[model samples]
Target: MTSTEPDARSSSTTSEGATSQPSGLPRVLSVTLTLAAVTITLLGLRQIGSFVGPVFLGLNLMLVAAPLFGWLVRIGMPRVVASISAVLAVYAFLVVFVLSLWWSISVLVNEIPAYASKFQELYLQLLDQLQAIGVSETMLTDQVASIDKQQIVGLATDLAKGIGDGVSIMAIVVTVLVFLSMDAIDIKRRIQLVRDAHPTVADALTRFGDGVRRYWVVTTVFGLIVAVIDVVALGIIGVPFALVWGVLSFVTNYVPNIGFVLGLVPPTLIALLDKGVASAIAVVVVYSVANFVVQAIIQPKYAGDAVGVTPTVSFLSLLLWAWVFGATGALLALPATLLLKAFLVDADPRGRWVNALIASRPGGGETPDPDVPEADEPDEDLVGVDGRADGENDSDDGSKPRG
Candidate 1:
């Protein structure tokens, strides 16, 4: 009876403990709830997309200029002077970009009207060719008559007007940049405060800043090379507004994956309208060769390393952010994705598994590549303030807190 009493007591205790412990929601239910929350949050963000896009753009600009700001401060420049100089530098770039875009759009609007007679001639030639191939003239006329010079002119006018309207948005972005730059004067100290309480968050922010800076540096360098190549090729081909197309190419380089296509279309179309089909073909071939060799073959390796996301993720991020914030989102997709990944994946120990899915290389950057020979000592440029490689953890246990 005594032996049985202890067994009964143990069974009772086990049952009580089991009943007292909390049970997690079912996996399906948890996922559904999370998805619902995300949907709602996205909808809210979409409502304020105008404000969000400019603010985010400012933040990205600040990140790119941060190193310059730091260098100026280190070189004995006053904090206030350095901060203003950085802000002005960014603001100057923005002004030049806006003016260039305005000039390009205005020139396009002016030039498009001059092509009306040529467009009519081409239209007749196309119709005659279609008739030769047995397509009905009446059917072709009815189907294609809507596409005329006036419609093209109207489209160009609308585009120019849209650019004019964006001046307000640019003002907001400039305002944000100024404020963010001022705050950045003490950013390191602020980060230290954040590190004291939430080390993971601090690390995530730091990584995000570093990633954005590297991305911009790589992208801008490649973009300039591609743009110059495009301009020289177009000039040799007698394409009008080659300089404008060059600027467009540089700007569109920020958009991932399809950016080359976007930059290619305007020049090709202009070549077609101005020179001929042969000239258009030449333009396409040159752009393809130049952009493919540089952007596709070479840029991706550096970009993949800089951003640490696979091609698939970068493309998907372009689509998703484009949907969320419109055209501006497309421009800011990489940085925005980096921010999300830093906080949601890198900041959480359990979420590290997601890196395997999204990371550009094996082991989510945690493992060194077997193909590359190991360095006896880490390169000084690769080392972070914590005496570890930029993305490396301090401990080998994989338990060290990271973001």
Candidate 2:
């Protein structure tokens, strides 16, 4: 969803509008062939989705943690060793962290059925008091009963889904991280070979990898800081399942605009069940303020102008990716979209067309003028291709795009 445009036109070649080569038959045949290829690919993609999902998961893992690997290599370790070490450490930490979170949440969840009965009794008592105030207690009681049953069913479904996905997702993620991290060197080497044969496409792929890696690294750190803040704030408020909620904050914050609300809802509801409506309100307020402070204040200082995705584009990517890949897709939408944009968007003829369409300002896809030039080739500079162009990115932070 985000566009990380570079400052310079380094390895790129900017091609202006298409040459006038009118062959209506060739064009029609090309379109028909492309559609056929797409249909076949989509079917294959779905059939092997179980395997494909993990590979995508691993790619994102490598992306989110690439900086750490780069840093470790910088200090002393060989790139291979550092990459392996950093990847192992990250997965180890995530496994420990996620398990701890799941365990804590499960404990609170198990106690909820008991609390459900208590909640029903409290609601009845409150209804009787309301009846004393010239209210119709029977009507209020019936409404409360209906609401309680609905909530119970909802909670049950959510919990079951969570538990069902938790272990497999984590395992897939960890395995993918290992595979991607370990094979990254080989991938890079193979890409270099291809660059000799197809420099433009190879460069585009490289550029996209750099962008995706940087995007994930920046976002993950941003989310981690938010997660820490959530844990501290929720812990202070004595929210049950505070750790798991913190993990949710970390994950959901990546989902763009609506993700913030998704992170807030579960904990606020749990607070309502545990303490009172007042506690729930407090939880909501804390989350809103914390998110504002992290995203509006702190993150901008660090992220700078790295990602220029609009709210609409972000949400669209979320929906589209989720639809294509299912549950895992929803979780990995933004990162995957960024990756898709980076690798396939600029170099490939198809990518050029799609990017042109997406870059159109706030309107339906307008067939761009065929004469608009194509970019030459992709490189590190492609990371900042969408930015306000200067000679080069002079910031000490190397992540920024330079022309």
Candidate 3:
């Protein structure tokens, strides 16, 4: 008996023969079954997407902390010790964040009623000023009284609910974060299993992990710049609550697009109350210039492409994920997009296009390999992109890439 498997040139013939045989039915059935299994798995996961978010977040955290954990283990520390250390580091940061949030809210809660009264008074005062400046009384009153009181109150009430929603997102983040810290390994393994190609999968996993953490670091750097600029500019312009407004900028900056506007609201309103229209306009100028300069100019210069994501994809993904998972997903959009880009989209047929769009480099186009010698099939020891190789490679004389 002889093996009769066809070569690439004869694959069409082989496929035709295969289609003519009984094996064809089984092959089609197998493919259909496999596809059905995948569809079912994804649909099941989709039903519990909320749960998946935290698991993915946890996996990302584990990947980020694995280096530190490994270092601890190497220095004779137990796994438990390393885990505790990782959790504590994050816990400490959260504690600080909570304290700051509490302080800011305390101020806002106390200031709200007063702020409202002050706003009403400022509007009346603005009407007087405009009238004095030779504006027609009818025009000034029409502008100030554009809406009926009921509509304004309803809008205000809706805004309060929205603020409450923001708080809910933070609570969910905290609770999910604790789980991520507790069972990091399980999450890491889940992500590692996402790809079939071992070495490519593992390499992709590490890069995926690195991309998440790197995004956090980069965003923080940009956030700080915006915060500092807001603080200095607002403080110079005599905006009340300059420090709290700066803090506001830092936190809301995570949301993109809307963050600068969110930061502007309190200071601009406060300025409106304290110093009238000139002050409010000045505050707007301050925010616009600082954000425009930092985001449009300085930050972009410093932010080289670390995660391969296009702005359009990011904005759309932010909206989509936020809709699915609420504000928490919007906040986590960068990390989540990184995972999709690395593990999901990068493997798709349009991978090169996706890569180009996400890439920070001038061009992220894939290169073509020249037809050359087979390169000895790489040393068995040489890991395929998956980070694993045949045991034979370990025994072979040094003929592989250094780890």
Best model per lDDT: 1
lDDT per model vs. reference:
0.75, 0.62, 0.60
State the lDDT of candidate 1 residue by residue for 331-364, as single tens digits. 7888888888877776665455677778887563
How accurate locally is residue 341 in candidate 2, as Cα lDDT from 0 to 100? 54
Q: Which lDDT value does model 2 have at 299? A: 57
Q: On a 0 to 1 TM-score scale, where does candidate 3 land against the true structure?
A: 0.64
Per-model TM-score, in order, reads 0.72, 0.63, 0.64
Compared with the true structure, what per-residue lDDT tens digits does model 2 show for residues 286-313?
A: 8888889877566544342233234445
Q: Over 4 Å off in model 1, which ranges?
A: 1-36, 105-165, 235-244, 255-262, 288-302, 362-403
Task: TM-score for candidate 2, please give it.
Answer: 0.63
Task: Kindly list the per-residue Cα lDDT of model 3 for residues 41-68, writing each as its tens digit.
Answer: 6566557766665555545555555566
Range of the 10 consecutive residues with the lowest summed lDDT in candidate 3: 379-388
Worst 10 residues of 1 by lDDT: 378-387
Error of 3 at 351 (Å): 4.8
Off by over 4 Å in 3: 1-71, 108-124, 130-164, 185-197, 255-258, 296-304, 345-358, 362-403
Comparing 1 and 2 by TM-score, which wins? Answer: 1
